[model samples]
Target: VTKPYRLRELIARIRAVLRRSGSEPANDVIMSIGEFRIDTIRRSVVRDGVELELSRKEFDLLALFASRLGQVVTRDECLDEIWWGRDLADTRTLDTHVKRLRQKLEADPSNPIHLLTIRGVGFRLDP
Candidate 1:
């Protein structure tokens, strides 16, 4: 049982929920920038017509970066989104993941052109 709810409020809430549920189909989400293409519904990433095999977290991390291309995403934001707000003593984990991601994403991991470091800031994905 719930507390009393106004008819208008209840109807609005139901409509909002329904709208979010299937207003837009998942298959419609095909994000692309330059040679990179990500089919979120299919959970696949393709660069230059070549598919890149990635771990679950790796894919998620890349997707996050891809969503905000050319913008530096802060460490705290990454930690919060990926690690669910877990406070890490250091960014070693994030660094490692980024390194691995760069390996798959960049032509030269050592001298990366796409995934770049901001030096004390965070990371940016340049398409």
Candidate 2:
């Protein structure tokens, strides 16, 4: 019983530390692009003021794109940053995540308004 309590305390301390260091901004909790808004702290995305459901990977991908809006983010960069430098197991993983993100956030997934794929390079999030 005492051991479990001690473990819980340790876990709580680690969580607190991670939360302090994580991406949640101190002042601004929102990232907005046109009708889309992302709450970084809440890990939620809203389009036209309506909440959109997203998987963990999808949310991370969107957050990364939003953080680097208007900048080209390469596959390796994304894999390293979002996947925590872990091997993606397949290069297609990034593509898949991007596709999902586009489907959710883009006005037209085929033509894509916000998420733009740069042929032979990578992707850019238009601001």
Judged by lDDT, which candidate is best?
Answer: 1
Worst 10 residues of 1 by lDDT: 1-10
For candidate 1, give the lDDT. 0.79
lDDT of 1 by residue, 1-127 (tens): 1457555445545554564476665544788877889887778999989999988878878877876789998886677666655557787999999999999988889999989999888999988
State the lDDT at 20 in candidate 1. Answer: 45
For model 2, residues 1-127, the per-residue Cα lDDT tens digits are 2453454445545554564478765555798877888898899998887999999999988887777889998886677566655555688988988898889887779988789998888888886
Query: What Cα-based lDDT does every candidate model obtain?
Result: 0.79, 0.78
What TM-score, over all chains together, does every model reach?
0.76, 0.76
Task: Specify the poorest-scoring 10-residue window by lDDT in model 2.
Answer: 1-10
Residue 18 CA displacement from its true place in model 2, Å: 12
